[model samples]
Target: MSSPQSPQSPQPSQQPKQGIACLGVLGVVALVVILLVVINRGGGGSSDDADASPSPYVPSSAPYTPPGDPYTPTTDPYASGDPYSSPSPEPSPYTSGTCLNGTLPDSTTAQSVSGVEEVSCSASDAHYKVIETVPLSTDLSRCNGNPRTQYAFSYRYTLNGATINSYVYCLVGLGSYAR
Candidate 1:
């Protein structure tokens, strides 16, 4: 038969459990002390050292100033008036009765011609002679039905999307320069 145990004192079987609990508490206390020592060692300096030094960055309060006026307007030489003076105070070399030395396409299909220059009517190199002048038109119909006119030449000048000067010349073939 077993005897009853008192509440103030533990039984022999429970004594081992209390000893194990005390060892667990001592292990937790030791771990906490070790963790605190490692954290303090990893810190580079004390808090007092951080407070003694001044910060490196400082802000400016004065307004900024630029060196020169970068937004000034520039001057365009051809903006004031008509840069292409068609009918000048003096007579133009390309006017009627004058001659031009240049190549004309064999096809009478009417096309744009370049590399033509003014020449004297009597010159041997003169290919075509101007018979009439038509202003602001390159239309072949302007020279149509004219017996002496074999081809039409036009001139147009523009500045800044605006037509400055335009004209057309009625040409007559000279010698073997037909077509």
Candidate 2:
């Protein structure tokens, strides 16, 4: 029998396949470059160009407060008055005369005192001293409209010597005064 003819060697031509593959890759690369250029061009416009003609902003006139009369003076809500000019009423002298076992005098009175030179306290002795006597009015009418005046006398102390401080308070108002 004649030997079967060897199958034709597979053609070794790779150039056409390589060329087609290269063309496909080049096509994809070109598409990407074109897309990038379009995207960059689109992103270049700015809001500044749109606002090039800035209109002058004019504020509307506020409700006019017809120039000052006593009833319409500009009063500052947070303004404070001189403490000395309008002194608060003094609190009553502390009737208890001694600090209670676990209590101290209220600090408001201490602050209101006209002549408190210095205050000192010792933890061991549980004592306090105010170098100078502070004068305060205990009458409520004097400090009316002020809540701080009400409890002003509830706490206060004067250091006596080294081991004792006297606690004191004043009666604010008599019921008769309310009438």
Candidate 3:
């Protein structure tokens, strides 16, 4: 406990080991910082494999058609008729007494109803057929002052299994309303 040759603390010759260990830790930290700097410098930031570049700003153009312009009508322009003339009668494709799956004759088809015995909803077999079509009179007197005279055509559809009387009424080309 009282030996003068040996000191209470560690000897001076062993101090270099402490310094070496501290310096080694600092050297490893410096190497890690240098490696991070070199790796970041090599990268372009914009991922080339993932395609992170901003898309180009492109203004869209109108769609093109070959034969018919969508803005123009297909009807004959030189036909002798008034531009504001009244719409033709029975303009609707369907009327009352049409089933859900039933295919009724259109205005053009019904116009020549005298020729068509019945219209077939089926392409091969008889699925639904228009049995009878009678043109009712367009009289507003039946409906007091109401323009419901569009109920002019009476269509009847029949399916072999008990008749599903799904009556659907539709009329086109009523004159412009008093709006």
**Candidate-wise lDDT, in order:** 0.76, 0.43, 0.43
TM-score of 2: 0.19
Which pairs of residues clash in candidate 1, taking residues 3 or more apart in a chain or in different chains?
none
TM-scores of the candidates are 0.44, 0.19, 0.23
lDDT of 2 at 105: 36
Cα lDDT tens digits, model 1, 21-75, are 9999999999999888886786545678756967687658766766676565466
RMSD of 1: 19.4
Cα RMSD (angstroms) for every candidate in the order listed: 19.4, 18.6, 19.6
Give per-residue lDDT, candidate 3, residue 157: 39
**Highest TM-score against the true fold, candidate:** 1
lDDT of 2 by residue, 87-160 (tens): 33333432322221222334443444333221223233323222222234333233334443323332333344
Model 3 lowest lDDT segment of ten: 170-179
Top lDDT: which candidate number? 1
Candidate 1, after superposition: displacement of residue 160 in Å? 4.1
Q: 2 or 3, which is superior by lDDT?
A: 3
lDDT score at residue 179, model 1, on the 0-100 scale = 56
